[model samples]
Target: MRLHPDIPPGPLHEKWDNCRFSNTLVNPANRRKYEIIVVGTGLAGASAAASLAELGYNVKSFCIQDSPRRAHSIAAQGGINAAKNYQNDSDSVFRLFYDTIKGGDFRSREANVYRLAQISNAIIDHCAAQGVPFAREYGGTLANRSFGGAQVSRTFYARGQTGQQLLLGAYSSLMRQVAAGKVTIYSRREMMDVVVVDGQARGIIVRNLLTGELERYSANAVVLATGGYGNAFYLSTNAMASNVTAAWRAHKRGAGFANPCFVQIHPTCIPVHGDYQSKLTLMSESLRNDGRVWVPKKTNDL
Candidate 1:
């Protein structure tokens, strides 16, 4: 199959608005008739599941973990960057977009990155409304900090547990949907394959981790927010359970894979000597932000 991003036609700033305006709205009343399957319960999956359920769609959310709260997103110890301009440091959507594009070595799609930048502030507001305890100033304004890559202090965080708090916010929304019967969550089940029907992804086949039984579930649509393949590198900062299977399966069944090499490596890490697959002990990302990363002058001195 061919891959076409179908980027919105317009200027970078107007493309997102045009795209949003052109999106065909699903009938809210008929939304309940559509069963949407969301694989992975991390921030991306959980937020999508919660939002779709809120829109009156029936959602089936699956995860490999016994508890949704335990997704690798919780292990994140840094802050999230937004173009809120809370610091009054001249941060803007375009600036954030440019910075991100430059950080990606100019390889990222400008339209997509621009859209992400435009929605950055809204993301912070939504998470805050969800009761994410972000660090704030003494005057009750949201706090900002300088993180890696960006010169401006646009990073908003809940101390060192930004990911944990954000995930909690998304999880709360998801649980509320589950309680209302709008969403059904399947935990401890790993998606073994994507089930496609009529050139469309309709469902998935999952393996029950506890029973070793294969189960097939079909949906009107499927979403795979199963995250990165960092664990395939053998030694990395990603959670141990994080694997490439779900994404690989999707790729095999007609999905576009982009920028697999765009992986983040925490600079402050121990040079552990062992098998190549052995996981390395990484220091907090926030730590290196406060100080410089020191390297040994000679080989094998770590």
Candidate 2:
């Protein structure tokens, strides 16, 4: 059977609004019956698990790190993009969408990109409400900065640790759900396989890194936020433990990989320092705002 995305039949601007209104809502009383297993605890996974638990679902969140906050997302140094137009730079949802599409060379789906742009402002507001401590101007308003591929000063940041602050916000929410007994967190557990029952993902098998023990977890649905397969290259900006194992196992269980070749390379990564170096360090993309890019004409030139 072929799959069709439930894209609403309307103008590009109205599709998301129309779809949200037309979608079916689950009764709050019945939400407790569903158990969702969210693999990985980065920004996407933690936020998802927290949000689902807040909506009354029983959520099991897993991460390979000793603490959920240590997920690779915390290593990101750049700020997040939002269409707040705080600088009155003519930035809008459409402009953000167009810029993203152009940056991706128009390979991204219009619906997905448009939806991301639409929610960009809400993301910033949500983060700020979580006390993310974003950089602000002397007037006490949130500060904005220009980032690569955008002319507007629309990137909201928290000094140079934007990802850390953002992850802390989500991590705080996740821990709140844990305290309320709405979410269960499995740290230092790496997903080994996706268990498919009757052609549907029903559970997962994970390995306890500390004890080398294998465990089975059954859930109504499994969400893989296990990040990318950049580690497949053997040398990348990904964490040391970042691997394709989870995604690879899912693919073996009949999940199709999309755009596997669309891996991104940060041009600002630190040059390899030695032959033994295992991972590349990334300089924040925001540095381009003032830093210049150049190369030495001779090997001995500093």
Candidate 3:
């Protein structure tokens, strides 16, 4: 089989707009005919499932945690990046894309990176509409903070608990879908395998963590938004339960893993002191807004 990203053909700025206008649209009445199984309820999974259900598709969202809000995304304390340019520092979609590409050593795909920069503002708007309680300025406008590797202040945060607040916003949206009977959520269920039928992913086999029973679920499509595999390092900052089980199962079932070597290191993680330490705690990157990072001149310097 051949792999092709099938990126839309157009100039960088126009590609996304062209694709959106050209893509096929499912009729609203026919949306209910399809069932989508979304594995993992992190920001991506929860938002995708909720949005699809709101568009009239039958969605079954699963999370190993007791609640979608407990997903490892809640550990993200730094803040989210956007190109809103509220600081009037000339930040734009292209600048955000360029900064990210350079920050990643230009290894990321241009199309994907540009798309991320484009939709970032929409994400903030959506979250705000859901009452995310983002930090605001004295004038009652949204606040912005400067993070590393960026000249402009484009990071939007909710005090020091940005991720927790964002997750709550997404959880509220998911719950709204559930209350409307458009989405069914299953917590404490871990995806153990992807069920591919006739070379197409058709369903999944999940293990109920609470019951220790394996259950098979069939769906028209399967969406794997499981979080990263940082815990594969055995002592990273990820939650202990945030293993790569779902991703590994999918890989074993035929899905290809990309850039497995690209692991992000948080420079502010707490130093490991003993063998008993199971995970590293992160010092929020937002601290850099006021604090400076430096090393001691002597080995014993405090």
What's the count of clashing pairs in each model shown?
Answer: 0, 0, 0
* Cα error of candidate 1 at position 171, Å: 0.5
Per-residue alpha-carbon lDDT of candidate 1 for residues 107-190, written as tens digits (9 for 90 to 100):
999999998998899999999999999999999999988887688989988988998999999999999999999999999999
lDDT of each: 0.89, 0.90, 0.90
Whole-model lDDT, candidate 1? 0.89
Model 3 C-alpha lDDT per residue in residues 102-155, reported as the tens digit of each score? 988999889989999999999999999999999999999899999976889999
Comparing candidate 1 with candidate 2, which one achieves the higher lDDT?
2
lDDT of 2 by residue, 221-264 (tens): 99999887788896899887777788889999998777888887
Compare candidates 2 and 3 on TM-score and give the better one: 3
Candidate closest to the true structure, highest TM-score: 3
- Error in Å for residue 177 of model 3: 0.4
Worst 10 residues of 3 by lDDT: 285-294
Residue ranges of candidate 3 with Cα displaced over 4 Å: 294-299
Clashes in model 3: which pairs?
A: none
Per-model TM values vs. the true structure: 0.95, 0.95, 0.96
Q: What TM-score does model 2 achieve against the real structure?
A: 0.95
